[model samples]
Each structure stands twice: as structure tokens, then as C-alpha cells.
Target: MAFASYPSLRDKVVFVTGGASGIGATFVSEFHAQGSKVAFVDLSEDEGRALSGKLAGSWFRRCDVTDAFALQSAIRDAAEALGPITVLINNVANDTRHDAASVTPEQWRKALAVNLDPAMVASVAVYPMMKQAGGGSIVNVSSINAIWGPGHMPAYVAAKGAINSLSKGLGREWGPDRIRVNALSPGWVITPRQLELWLTPEAEAEWSKLVALKDRLMPEDIARMAMFLAADDSRMITGQNFIVDAGRL
Candidate 1:
């Protein structure tokens, strides 16, 4: 499907976390297609390098977002490579399911670190850059699992819920600086990881029955909403959760 182009996004600086594959990859590609200067970081070095090469002028750095210091350093390096990041897409997350009964303290902490902490740390690291640029947009990728109260992966749900809350708080905190922050919640996007790990025939049929739209969501579906949030089209929108869930919620 052809999507509308945002003239405001032309030449804007964009940074995305976990942009080597899946939904995050779409964010990097879409922003680049819109003429934004894109720099992205991911743990998958090979995929990241390939994607960066595919999109000329885009920068790719290997970063594990769980490490707060490393994440901050990556943001700095991305800014240096692509100028101050005026559009930050906090899209890194690990949704590996674990039995609540078997979840240890360390496991819980790791889940939060991967799914939640980076969003906050990355936003903090880029605040000055965004402010100095006059204004900017931050889109925190969340999930419908947080709102649906799904069973299994309790830590993932908790972390995503925290992300939604953090987005709201940062939106208010930085609004005066002309910075906008919003949470983008997606439902059942069929990425390669999901197809490999979770998208069984039974699961797909059940989810299809629940969503208002018959078609399953894709990475580009979520990316389109993100692009709008990052562009001037959403200049007045902030502190809200934008769900691209086919009306499941």
C-alpha cells in the first residue's frame, strides 16, 4: 500500500533502537524513504550492517539496549553521525515468554531492563539534542499485551505498561521545550520472530477472530503511525497512546 509522504520529515534526523529487523527495521527504512537522515542500533551486527548498506547514508551501530551506558553512548554516536536526533523511536523490546512460577528475581529485572529501561534512558540522553534542535518527537513502541492483560510473560506486560506511563510523563515534562512524546501500541504484528516463535495456526485463527479488521497487522502498519507521530503532522499530539491494533482494544 502506498503511504502519504511528510514533507516535514525531509532531512530530519532520526534514531531508532533495534532497527536491524522486524518492526524497527521498517521504522528505519520508512524514515529514510521519507528523506530523513536515519541512524539505528541493534545487537544483530550482520543484519544491521546489511540494512545500513542497503540504505545509503544511514548509520548502524551494534548496541545492546539493556546496557544503559552503552545505549547512551550509541545515541551520542548516532547524533554525531547524523546530526542531533530530532526524531527518536524507542523500539527495542524482548517479549520472550516465561512461566511466572519459574521467573526468578534476575529474570524479572532482565525483562524490565530490556523492555522498559532503554526507552527512559534513551529519551533522557536525547533531550538536550532535541531541545537544541528547537523541537523533536519521541515515539515509544509499546504493545497491546499491556492493555489486554495477557497471561504469561508478566514481566513483559509490566514493562510495556511502564513504557506507556513513561511516555505520558515525558510528554508533559518536555512539552514546554517543544518536544513531543507518545506511545505507539501495536497488536499481533507478524514479524519474522513472531512467525518463528509464536504465530501458530491456532494462535493466528484465534487472533483473527478477535481483531475488528480481518487482516493481520504488519510492521509497515505500525511504522506508518510512527512516521506520523515523528512528523509535524502530529505537532499538537502528545502524552497519548496511539494503538494500531485493528481495533482489538
Candidate 2:
């Protein structure tokens, strides 16, 4: 499907985390297609390098988002490569399911660190850059799992819920600076990992019965929402959770 182009996105510098593959990769590609200068970081060196190589005017850095120092350093390097970041996409996450009863303290901390901390860290790191740019947009990729309160993976759900709250708080704090903060919560996105681990024929059949729309949610669908949030087209939108879940509530 054809997507709309945003004139304001042209020449903007965008930094994306977890952009080596899946939904994050779509974010990088879509933003680049809109004429934005893109810089992305991921733990997968080979995938990151290959993606960057394929996209002109894009840079890739290897960094683990859970490590604050590494994440901050990568943001700095991205800024040096592509001008100050005017758009930030916090898209990295791991949604590995686990029994709540068996979750240890370390596991819980790791879950939050991976799914939530980096968004805050990256936002803080780029705050000055965005302010200096006169204004910017931050799109935090969240999930519908938070709202649904799924039985398993308590930590993952908790992190996403916190992200929703964080987005609202940050939005209020940064509104005066003209920096918009918003959350994009997706539902049942059929990424490579999901296809491999969860999207069995039977599972797909069940998911189809859950949403209002018949079509499955794709990475591109989420990317399009990110593009809208990042562009001037959504200049007044902030502190809100935009759920692209095909009416799954």
C-alpha cells in the first residue's frame, strides 16, 4: 500500500534504536524514504551494518540499549554523523514470555531495563539536541499487551504500562519546549520473530477473530504511524497512546 509523504520530514535527522530488523527496520526505511537522515543502533552488528549499507544517508552503530553508557554514546555518535536528532524512535524491546511465579528479581530488572529504560535514557540524551533544533518529536513504541493485561510475561506488561505513563509525564514536561512525546502501541504485529515463534496457523486464525480489521498488522503499519507522529502533520499531538491494533481492545 502507498503511504503519504510528509514535506516537513525532509532533511530531518532521525535516530532509531533496535533498527536492525523487524519493526525497527521498517521505521528506519520509512523515515529514510521520507528524505530524513537516519541513524540507528542495534545489538546485531551484521544486520545493522547491512541495513545501513543498503540505505544511503543512513548510519548504523552497534550498542546495547540496556547499557546506559553505550546507549548515550551511540546517540552522541549518531548526532555527529547526521546533525542533531530532530526525531527519536525508541523501538527496541524483547517480549519473551515467562511465568510470573518463576520470575526472579534480576529477570524483572532486566525486563524493565530492556523494554523501558532505554526510551527514557535516549530521550534525555537527545533532549538538548531536540531543544536546540527548535522542536522535535519522540515516538516510543509500546504494545497492546500492556492494556490487555496478558496472563504471562508480567514484567513485559509492566514495562509497557510504565512507558505509557512515562510518555504522558514527558509530554507534559517537554510541551513548553515544543518537543512532542507520544506512544505507539501495536497489536499482534507479524514480524519475523513473531512468525517464527507465535504466528502458527491456528494462532493466526484466533487473532483474525479478535480484531475489527480482517488484515493482519504489519511492521509497515506501525512505521506509518511513527512517521505521522514524527512529522509536522501531528504538530499538536502529544501525551497520547496511538493504538494501531485494528480495534482490538
Candidate 3:
């Protein structure tokens, strides 16, 4: 089904990471439209607070997902405010392109901390809660680089590969609890930052050539798939990675 016509998410509480802007913000808006009470964390205090206010039923907390204590506190407070979260979207990622030789040890750690640790921490935090609440869904946002590394971002590719594996491992471990875990890997989506930084006319033309679809994958396109995974419609799907790449691979 099309995203707008997807199943109702009334009474569901969804927690999203890095949700102040880009694809994460798109997920927040889409979930709100589905009637879910959304809670999200982001480093951008102003945008986070403003978006929270704009989305009346949603809550936004200023947090760096790399910080375990902050993430725990934010999740706990948001759960208290919105009730037991029925969905967790591990959408926080550090996609700053860096080559292997250029990446320092600290930079590599930061990349994994941002792209992979948040999923583990958030999913683990929600485990007992979801078990007590009956069941829920966890969607880890991976990247096309994980499947097809383009060479520019070694750390990003490594981190995303870890995310995909982590999702699968958690899915198998948590299947007994009825908590679904999966990954969503998107291709060259035209976010504002990407358009400004990466999408030169030549880059756009090359990216388009890789995809079968004439149109590029938008934030909404990825958000729609995320919503499906978050909802009960995909109850039986777990330990799987869905590529919303417009056939980039």
C-alpha cells in the first residue's frame, strides 16, 4: 500500500533517534500523520524543540546518541511522557564521508558510536519494556554503502555493515519476545544537505543511471517503508533488510 494509505497507528508510541532533520525528521512527520505519538532525540536543540512543539503530541529531547547516559535518560523520560513505546527507529547516523587513510581512531569510533551503538543501546533499552508491553518493532536505518561501498566513506560503510548485522542478530535473539527487528538501507536520497554537498549535476546524472526508477528516492519514500516496518502490517518480517534504493544495487 502507498504510505499515506498505510494502516492506522493510533495509540502507538514511537521513539526515533536523530530526528531533528533529514530522513529522521521525515519519519517523525510520517508517524505523526499515522496517528502515532512520537518521541525523538537530536543534538539540534532549537530544531528539536520547535518540531516537537509543532507536532503537538510529540516529544523531542536534546541528546547525542553516542552518549549512553543521555540516551537512557531521554528514552526513559520520553516513555514516561508517551507511555510504553511500541516502536523504536534507530535512524541516527554519522554519514560524513571519510576515506580509510584519512580516518583517525577517534573518527572511526565516533562513526560506529553514531551509526551502530545507538541501535544496540535503544533496542536493548526497549527489550524488557516491549516484553512487558507485549511486543514492538525496531527498525535500524542502514545505508546503501553497506551493501555497495562507493569507496569515499570507509568508516560509514563499516558502521552501516555493523548496523545491518546487529539488526539481524537482535532479530534472532528477540524473536521469542515477539519484538521485530529489521533494517532499512536507502540509496541516494536528495536531502538538502546532500543536494548542497554531493549532488552536483554530474553526480545526480550518475546516481540516476544506477537506479531503474526515473525519480530519486525522497525522504518520504524511505519514511513510508519505515512506517510499514513500525506498523503491525509487517508483523511477520524480522531480521531482514529492506532496500529503498530505487534499485541502486
Candidate 4:
């Protein structure tokens, strides 16, 4: 399917976290297709480099988003290499599964570090640039699990829950500056990681039975919503949680 293009996105600087693969990588490619100057960082150096090479003029860096300093530095470097980032996609996340009963204090901290902290850190890093640009969009990649509360992954659910509130709080605080903050929640997007780690036929069948849309949710499907949120079309929209979950609630 041919997605609509946004003229405002052309020549804009887009910064994405964890853009080496999965939904984040799709964001990098899709924004680049819209002629946005894309700069992405991921821990996967080889994949990041390959993606950057595939898209001429795109920038890639190896960054572990858990490290607040490293994440901030990467954003700064991306801005310097490209330009002031007007679109920041906080797409870095690790929804690692674990039993809630077995979770330790360190494990809880680690989960928040990976899933919750980076969104705030990255958004803070780009605040000045967006302010100077007069306006910008910040799309925090959250999950429907934030609301669903599937008990198997308690930490992930908690972190994502925070993301929703974080987006709203940030939106309220920064809306006066014209920096819009919103959360993009995806439900069971079949990415490489999900395919490798989970997507068995039996599991897929069970998931299909639950969602309103029977088809598989691809990365581009989620990326397109993000593009709209980042573009001028969503100028009046802010502080909301958009679930691209195919009627999963």
C-alpha cells in the first residue's frame, strides 16, 4: 500500500532511538522515504551501519539507551551531523519477559532504565533544539500492554504505563513551547525480534482471535502513525495515547 507523503517532513531532521531493527528501523526508512534527514542510534552496530549505508545521507551511531549520558550524547551528535532534530521518536525498548514473583530490585531498576528512562532523557536532550525550531513533535513508542496489564511481563507493563503518563506530563509542560508529546502504542507488531522470540503458529492464532484485525500488524503499519504524529498534520494533537492495535483496546 502506498502511504501518503508529508511535504513538511521533507528536509526535516528526524532522530530515532533503537533504529537498527524492528519498528524503529521502519521509522528510519519511512522517514527517509519522506525525504527527512534521518539520524538513528542503536546498540547493534553492524545493523545500524548497514541501514545507514542503505539510506544515503542518513546517520547512524551505536548507542545503549540505558546510559543516559550516552543517549544524550548520541542525540547531540546526531543533531550536529544532521541538523537540529525536529522529530524525535523514542523507539528504544526491551520488553523482556519474566515472572513477576521472581523480579528483584535490581531487575526492576534495569527494566525502567531500558524502557522508561530513555524517553525522558532523549526528550530532554532535544527540548532546546525543538524550542529553537519554533515547534517539533515527540512520539514516545509505548505499548498497549500499558493498559492490558498482561501479568507475565510486569516490569514491561509498568514501564510502558509510565510512558503514557510521561507523554501527557511532558506534553502539558512543553506544549507552550510548541513541542508536542504523544505516545504511539502498538499491539503485537510482528517484527524480526518477535518472529524469532515468540511468533509461533499457535501463538499467532491465539493473538489473531483476540484482535479485531485478523491480519498481521507489520512495522510499517505502526511507523505510518508515527509519521503523521511527527508531521504538521497533527499540529493540533498532543498529550494523547494513540493505539494502533487493531481494536485490541
Candidate 5:
């Protein structure tokens, strides 16, 4: 089946975080397919490099998002190689299940570091470039779990909830400069990480029972929404949280 195409995306430079695998990798491939020059960073060096090698004009760097300096450096390096970034996808996150009762201060800080800080850091790093380019789009990858607030993931839920707010805050702050910011909230996408550590048959069955749509969600499903958000088609859209979860919300 054929999908929509964005003629405006051709030749645009896109930067994605946590983009070596899962939905992030799909972001890399899909944007490249749209004729955008894609550059991505992730901790998974092997997958990142392999994906970069597969795509003719793609760039990849292995950087831990938790390290603000490293994350900023990678973004700068990508900008240096590709042109000024016109699109930013803040897709880095770790949603490991943990007991709320047992979460230490350090663990809580770490959770925010992984899920929240990099978005701000990357956004700040790209602000001047986007401003110089006259405008840009920023997609903050959020999760429906932020709304669902399920048990065993207190830290993740908190951090993701913060991301939603951050998207709005940045949107308001950057709108004057024509920088659009919005959150993309996905529901229960069965990426490799989810399938490996969670998503047991029972969990899958339970999720199936909840959503209105019959088909399971895929990385491409989420990435397509991101494509629209990143493209000029969404130029006037900002500060909104788009939920792409098969009507699960």
C-alpha cells in the first residue's frame, strides 16, 4: 500500500535521538525515504552505524543522552556535517518498570535524565540554527503511559508526563522564532525493547482488548505520525500532543 509523501521534506536536515533502533530507527529510515538528510544519535553504536551505512546520506553518532554535554556535542557535530537542522525528534527514553516504593533519589534523577533532560538540551542546541533558518519543527516523543499512569513505572510515568509539559513550554517559548514544538504520544508500540523485556502474551492480549483498533501498533505507525509532525505540512501546528495509539486513548 502507498502512503502520503511530503514534498517539502526533501533536502531538509533532521536530527533524531535514540534513533539507532526501534521507533527511532524507523524515524531515521522513513525520513531518509522522504529525501531528508537524516542524522541520528544513540548508545547502540553497531545498529546506528549499520543504519547509517545503509542510507546514502544518513549520519549516526553513539552518544548517551543522559550526558548533556555529549548529547549537545553530537547534535552540533550532526549540524556541522548535515546543514542546519530544520527538524528535531527527541525520541530518547527508558521505560524500565520499577517499584515506586523503592525508587531512590538517584534513580529518580536518572529517570528524568533519560526521559526529559535531553529534549531540553537538544532543543536549546538547535534553537539558534532553527531560528537562523527562519523556522523548524520539534517532535518530543511522549507515551500514553503518561496518561494511563500504570503501576510499576512511577519514575517513567513522571518523566514522560514532564515531557508533555516541556513540549508545550518550548512551543510557547519558540513560537516567536517560528520554531514549532509538539509532543507525539504513542501507545503500546511493540518495539524490540518492549517485546524483549515486557509484552508477554497475556500483556499483549490485554492490550488488544483495550484499544478500539484491531491491528497491533508498529514502529512505522508511530514514525509516520512523526513524519507529518516534522514536515512542513505541520508548520502551523504547535504545542499540541498528538496521540497515535490506535484509539487506545
Candidate 6:
């Protein structure tokens, strides 16, 4: 007799929002490796399609998470093409840092819609699907700034804080359904773009001072934790925010 396989996301269907780049892209790739049929959404048609082409078990759709109706439609289509979505990763957000006091009201609203509203809509959309699948996981990608109260990103901070609270509340509300909800908050992982455009010597010095790990954190580092959460290894974990900040408080 053949031994049973034990991949955490084996045969599960996962949908990731804003998975075109950064940490979101890593999530998509990691899940695909775990034997899950993964689908992701992004507004960048070229990048999204290219990623889909490269990944064996992945689907990509052009979607703007801020539009609830569009998101709903995209989710439905992804489900139809793939299978019932057992894992939902709400990771889409535009983090264009700006001076809070100078940001226009419209821009603030746009930021919140992209960062916070997508969490609500994505979670809500997957409720029935997860229920049908006999329970599932919803992992929201938040930021360390949620806890740090970072300056100049007032809107982003507010959105991430709301995501944390929403994660807890939803976990409580959906516990009976066997659906787990949680948040993954990452600290200063030096993405390629950040290094080229923003990471100064002063910033590197500060990072070294704060981080407990001598090695620098990268997108893959955060992706590893997400894989744990997506897998059954974290079956008992829910409503808690897992901070993968390289030991940075």
C-alpha cells in the first residue's frame, strides 16, 4: 500500500489578493509549492499573467481590491476556474507613503478602501465558500506599523490596526464554523524597491539595532511563516497576529 501524503495545503484551493509583487507574490509561490491550487489577483495584467504562466498550479486575474463588486466577481470566477477556495489571503494594499496632514480626503479614502475594505470584502466573500468546503483559513497580511504607530503613514497604520481587530472579531464569530482568521504582521524587510529607493545608511543602522537576528529579513522569510499558517501546522492558531519582524518589536 502507498503511504499517505501529508502536504499542509494538499488539494486545497487558495486565493490571494494583490499577489502581483512583494510579500503577496511570495505567498502565491509558496502555496503553489505546497500542492495547493492557487489563484491571485492584481491590477498589473502583464506581471500577473506572467507569474501565472510560470507557476504550474496558479491562476491570475486582473483585479483592483478596492472595488467590492469587481472583487466579488473575480473571486467567483477564480473559484469556478480552480475549485472551492479553502484559503483566502487578503494581502492587497497600496502603501504609497505620504504626509498625513497633506493627504487629500479622497486619497485617504482610497487608501483605506484598498487596505482595509478589501479585508472585509475578501473575508465576507469566502465565508460561504469555506463553509461549503467544511471550514478553511483566512490570513490577512497586515504590517508591524499597526503596532509601532509609525509616523507619516497615518492612513496605513489605521487600516492595519483595523485589520488586526477585524481578524480577532471574525475568528471569534467564525469559530463555530471551524474557520480560522488571523493576521501576519511583518517588520522592516528590505524589499528590492525599498533598497534602491529608500534604504539609507541610517535606516540600515536602525534596523541592525532593532532586529535580534543578525541576518536581514527578506520576502521569503515572511513567506515561510505564511506557509506555516496556511498549513495544518497552525491548525490550532487563530485570531492572533503573527509578527515576523526579524525580532524587531
Look at candidate 3 and give me any clashing residue pairs: none
lDDT of 5 by residue, 14-60 (tens): 99999999999999999999999999999999999999999998999
What's the lDDT for all of these models? Answer: 0.94, 0.94, 0.89, 0.95, 0.93, 0.87
Write down the lDDT that model 2 would get. Answer: 0.94
Which parts of model 4 have CA positions greater than 4 angstroms off?
none
lDDT of 2 at 35: 97
* Candidate 5: stretches off by over 4 Å: none
Tens-digit lDDT string for candidate 6 (176-220):
888999999988877766787779999888888988886778887
Give the clash count for model 5: 0
List the candidates' TM-scores in order.
0.98, 0.98, 0.97, 0.98, 0.98, 0.95
- Which residue ranges in model 6 land beyond 4 Å of their true spot? 1-6
Clashing pairs in 5: none
Residue 238 of model 5: what lDDT?
A: 94
Cα distance off (Å), candidate 5, residue 171: 0.8
- Cα lDDT of candidate 3 equals 0.89
Cα distance off (Å), candidate 3, residue 59: 0.3
Candidate 1: stretches off by over 4 Å: none
Deviation of model 3 at 88, angstroms: 0.3
Model 2 residue 221 CA deviation (Å) reads 0.5
The residue ranges of model 3 lying beyond 4 angstroms of the native Cα positions read: 1-8
